[model samples]
Target: MSKEKESVLEGFKAFLMRGNVIDLAVAVVIGAAFTNVVTSVVKGVINPVVGAFGTQDLNMYSSCLKAPCETNDAGEVVKGIPIMWGTVLSAVLTFLITAAVVYFLMVLPMAKYLARRARQQAAKEEVQEVMEVSELEVLKEIRDALVAQRGSGRNDPGRNGPGQSTP
Candidate 1:
């Protein structure tokens, strides 16, 4: 292949091999699967609870938008305009249920855990900083003492001070 073509292919391969791309693909697959579960829950559990008051299926509910709204033998709209508000209601309920489940079960717990970890990390860093400062203070004290000792030695009678020549 030409170098240009080869470079393009290599770039595509590198993009596909990236961790974020792989993670996104995995998330998409898992999300699709989770959606099915949520849909089933809405249809099976939520619908039945609402059914106690009216129709079991939310899709069955509707209002006549125009006059002469009628259904044929197969329950298909054969006459006037009908607004399928029940379907919209069902979709809204499904979305709310999904959001609640994701928030309470996943987002909330993760947020709490991250907050706790952050607090712990901050405390650890504070302790480390204090220790470093203590060590630095000790080092400074040691350096001062060494300087004092050297100065005293120079002042002694046996030791040469500054530029004085030893004869």
Candidate 2:
């Protein structure tokens, strides 16, 4: 039982040490840190700009269905359903900011780089294809010249290839 437990622990340790597991852990940590940065930016920058249009604190925005939403005597809600629109709006703005930042800072540049690399590869292949076609054309011309020389009657002295003469 002790040996079995030891082996199990070692197996678990090995599993945790794998590259994928480590990479995933790093990604999760970085993602958390990035989230905090984005959240700070939203709170610091966007909230103020959006606040110009309305309340700076979106959490304060709400509507009560009943006229008497609260009772001052009890200091609590007496009768009414409060719709918290501010919370929803805050979440929507945060999402939009995150999406825009990721798209502009990461996705757009990566896409452009991949597109340019693909175009360069295609140009190289096109040039290689043209060179291959040119080589084939030259080969065909050489073959035609050889056939013409042979058919023109080898008895002629001038038509023989260099280093060869009609004997």
Candidate 3:
């Protein structure tokens, strides 16, 4: 049981030391911070600008029924239920804007850079492989030459027929 526990601990230690795991942790923290900034931008700058051209505030949109929608006053049932579509519109707009910014600013450039790096790496690997094959061919030729030279030598007397009388 002790041995098993030690092995598990060793394995966990190796996992924690891996570069990819550390990089992923860093990326998550950065992404969380970036999200806060984007959210503030949506709520503060974009929402107000959109509200200026519209009849409703971005935050006030909701669906209400059975009573006066505003919490301040109670009105008769004759007035139809109020459904706030402005809030939904604001949310949809924010999502679109965020997605566009992330795609154009981060995702696209990262993808292009990665593709270029991969191409460069592949070219390097191909060159190394060709060099290795050429070296192997040279070694094979040397081996073949040695074998041919040995075969050309005269046979020794000791290598004659096995049934011959001993000296």
Could you say which candidate leads in lDDT? 1
Residue 101 lDDT, candidate 2, scale 0-100? 82
Candidate 3: misplaced stretches above 4 Å?
Answer: 55-57, 65-70, 73-87, 122-167
Candidate 2 overall lDDT versus native: 0.84
CA lDDT of 164 in candidate 1?
A: 74
Q: Candidate 1: which pairs clash?
A: none
Quantify all predictions' global Cα lDDT against the true fold: 0.93, 0.84, 0.78
Model with the higher TM-score, candidate 1 or 3: 1
C-alpha RMSD (angstroms) for model 3: 7.0
Candidate 2 residue 25 C-alpha distance from true site, Å: 5.9
Would you list the rank order by lDDT, best first?
1, 2, 3
Quote the positional error of residue 37 for candidate 3 in Å: 1.2
TM per prediction: 0.88, 0.70, 0.58
What TM-score does candidate 1 get on C-alpha atoms? 0.88
Query: Counting only residues 3 or more apart in sequence or on different chains, how many pairs clash (N, Cα, C under 3 Å) in candidate 3?
Result: 1
Ranking by TM-score: 1, 2, 3
Displacement of the residue 128 alpha carbon in candidate 1, Å: 2.4
Q: In TM-score terms, which candidate is top?
A: 1
